[model samples]
Target: MRVIDPRPLPPGVLAAFLDLLGPERAAEVRAAAVRIARGLDGGTLWHVNSTPRGGGVAEMLHVLVPLYRALGVPCRWAVVDGDERFFDTTKKLGNLAYGSTEPADRLGAGAADDYLAHLELEAAQLAGVLGPRDVLLLHDHQTAGLVPALSAKVAAVHWRCHVGVDTPTEGSAAAWAIMAPLLDRADGVVFSVAHHVPAELAGHRVAVVPPVIWPFAPKNEPLPDDATRVLLDRAGLGSGPVPGNVVADGPRDPDAPLAVQVSRWDRLKDMHGVLTAFAESVPDAHLALVGPDPAAIPDDVDQAHWFATCLDAWRALPLPTRERIRLVCLPMDDLDDNARLVNAVQRAADVVVQKSLAEGFGLTVAEAMWKSRAVVGSAVGGIAAQIDHGRTGLLLDDPHDLAGFADLVTAVTGGAVDGTALGDRAHEDVRRRYLPDGDVLATAGLLTWEIT
Candidate 1:
């Protein structure tokens, strides 16, 4: 129901990618831009989601929306307004979709009605703003409830789901059963992977669109010397001069090897696992667990609970081992600054980790790899797509295998594996596939084929 105005992003980012992409791929991008210019269909494209900050959806919009407009595509963004109860139900459904072993909270008939009523009110507000030719694109389960009302009012409604179950579980099945009708109203749906498309979606058109990272965004771009040191020190990582040879990193000792994982304090990201793996095996390497400060975003109702649990896990470690591992909550007052801090942390890390127990797609994985940092991620969902095992990055066969994770960390930090080589290849993979330029073409092609 509430909309956040998008700030202007620097234009001409795509122009720089021409050299990175070479003459052939750059021509393809130019061709897509020409197609986009020809196929406006006289409509404004609108993207709808829950929050304006945090999460992959918001982060992507922060970059993609600007790029689209800069490329001469007419697009706008809106964030839905919901109460705690609504978000609580959506969060439960999300975890269920992931087949989380945590306690199950069912969304029965009454609960579904409660959820619909809120979306109905929000849709009432949307009606006045959407024009006859305008089309709506909703992201994730958080905004799915609006599809019913939006379908009748808009030219087309495409439900794009960012979180998904790679392997269907009873909980995920139950979630789909409840959402089946609301989903049917949409003209099309988009998923991160082919497997993420639910069986129930067979009646509608579906597209597989991988989650992407902006290579030139403030968060993904490499930081300069003066800015890197000032931001790192301001973020509480200390003011030591940044090492010129390595990616800009935190303060400790210039040459100290570091392993880092930057994600929400969710159970799935397995921050505790990263800490345990480092303490048990790679004791010589320092570990940093970084996440957004909970106070920065209001929607993630479970952040405090998850963060407290991670703290409990950290406190249980021995004092000597504990001092080597740290928990960092970066300030979000300045989003660009927050992004830059993340950039520095990832670059500074000797090996970046994304040890999620379950992942829809690891945007952070691509972010790390884009910075040319070798990543060790769990072999699940989009992470499997991003990493080619021993080529771009290493993949853990099993997420829960602490010993196996420790072994890989030890191997990477000990120089048994060529991390720099892995990082170089990883950068190339992103340049070829995961860059946001592809997203523009993909979105335009999808809407062109489906909307008309």
Candidate 2:
């Protein structure tokens, strides 16, 4: 693990937060969170997700569980156990949730039996170590099936769905059928956005809790110059003086400008679309596509084969355009380094583009906005919620609209809009809407209302 500077809770961190939220509003939220925590006295809150690492759900729990402990709430996080076969089935279910209908082997009658057996085994092992007072907070569809098996033993269960569900496909329906009984048994359901909730779940009590970024956490703090350089070097971003030292170790050239897109190389992210837009809009600007390979999997079928296909696609880019583009896959353990790279990129970038075809709340947008960087993101999903056109950042309607995206990039980079003004507004927006303090309070309020 990369050791980060010790972050003590600063008085001003919470004070400034309260000021941004206003005393009356902040007090009410805090009181609610405290009430929720108090209500579950001696109960443990267990957060279960598909993977122990990677993705937003796991990332949020990384900080959230610890913070809950700090607040005197006993909480723990666990990963569901599954083989490649299991993950493939889940991935198919994921696609279905997104409204795609590729064929998949049905979970069959034995499927539920096998799944319950696994859940019982894990639950028994956990129960040996933990008392029955614990509350279970399940994340996404993958582990939602476990709820029914554990409902009798657990004090309460909450399902946190991170994906949007504007449309439901046959696969989604089947997956839901397998999991609905479990969800129906849940104490409550949590959605990241209002639109992410399915109509079938409308009658049930649903809570809208957006994911949050911890401002004082190691991954969110400012990096030192030496540390930044070391991280950049590891990512092969280069060393020495270059413009906008976005990659920590990369060389910085004060004269040149940079545009960065950080996301998994998944089809839904539209990485190629971003490349096309950048190529057409700012042909002269350096573009860096920074993220882990989407095809790489800790547990999934033919991940290496999938990864190879993505690599081939990247390698096939035209030489001239590819020269300006850099693809990086940071190790899972290097989250601190990733944060440093993000800070460096935002500090050095003239513009940060998300341009995602589909997004689950776009935490990257919130992150860049927190740093007060100008951003251009596609008008889809949660990205639209975070960005205000010509205010905090610009919103592009089409990811493939090369000419239009390019025009916005040029205007922002060429000083058409007041850079300082835009940055300041972006910062304010993050402070008001996406910070951890507010998020925790809102979640606590919802949990309190449900559990009480």
Candidate 3:
């Protein structure tokens, strides 16, 4: 197990929320966080998860840990070490949970042994340092196995699953076969949606918490018009003159509209679907599919395969249209730089899209919406819960409906749907419903419940 500093050197997560949440709400939030800190008589609140980079789980911890620390809580973050097999199995479970049709993968007895062995070793190492006064928080499936091992070591343990399939699927059943037993160790388990609570977990106390974006994070922060050019050019993802915004680092009409999606290079994100849809219907609009370099994210073994598949799809498009579409991998060596580049890309967009086949609440939607960019995404999982259909943002009835997606794209890019109006609604909705304050309060409540 490796203990690392929170990446991107968080810029006061609690303070960052002050402006967005305002004085009263901000003060109330501060009091809640402070209450947790003061209530912790002599123990630390420990957070455990997989990689501290690349995905949403990591992004949320990065935001939450700093805020809790500033509030005077002794919050610590540790990334569990795992072998490739461990990651691959976890990925299989995740894919199955997401309803991947590719023949469901299962963790066999030997594979299950391999998974437990690694977690046990890490748990032993962690147990040496933990005291009975400490509260252990195991995040997602990656750290779920450590629950039983650490149960006797810590004062309380809470397990939170950041990924879930709203609708039942065979893949989910297969994955849960290996995972359900681990939930037995959780004092309480948290999820992003109620529908994700499986039959085995029907009796456990479950809290459906929405994932939120810290507006101050490098990736979602506001960039000046000029910074957009410099950061975009620096990251090599895209470039533009002071006036053109970004044309994916290639020459294109200054007036041409742009639609973008920033997500991990995972099949579930549907980068290929976005590419094919753009090439076929929204030829007039430029598209950008941006994510962290696969080389930097050690856990995502499927990244290279997915990237190649998308690239192959991109090559199938007409030569002239190739210049209008960009398949980008931003450098992760510099977290701040990576975030600023993402911020520029999102802010430069006329519309943002997240056409995921499955999701645990698309924070990308909220990030883009916070930037006041209209979003068109599938009405599945948490995405449906975020956007109020036609009012805040557009949603597709069927995720596989590429033609309908194209029509939505055309509507946003054309003068028909008011992008600004939709963005306004989305931004406002996000402010009221999804924020770090809510997430913090929920965590505090959960911890308090377990302690009581």
Of the candidates shown, which would achieve the greatest TM-score relative to the real structure?
Answer: 3
lDDT of 1 by residue, 130-168 (tens): 877777889988788899888988778888988777788
User: Candidate order by TM-score, highest to lowest?
Assistant: 3, 1, 2
Per-residue lDDT of model 2, residues 258-309, tens digit only: 7777766555666666666665567667777666544445544433443445
Count of backbone clashes, every candidate in sequence: 3, 11, 0
> Scored by CA lDDT, what does every candidate get?
0.80, 0.66, 0.80
**TM-scores, one per candidate:** 0.93, 0.83, 0.93
Cα RMSDs, all models: 3.7, 4.7, 3.0
Better of 1 and 3 by TM-score: 3
Q: Where does candidate 1 stray beyond 4 Å? A: 17-23, 33-38, 104-109, 239-253, 450-452
Q: Residues 1-452, candidate 3, lDDT per residue (tens digit)?
A: 98767743445555656877999988878777776766566888888998888788788888888877776678888899887888987787778767665763555568777888889999998887788888887888788889889997787888888787877877788777778888787788888877877887877777778888887788777678778877766544444432222224355454789888999888888999998888887868888888777778887788888888887887777777887787778788877777788888888789999999889778888888888899999888889888888899999988889999999988999969999999998888888988788877877787777322
10 residues in a row with least lDDT, candidate 3: 240-249
Better of 2 and 3 by TM-score: 3
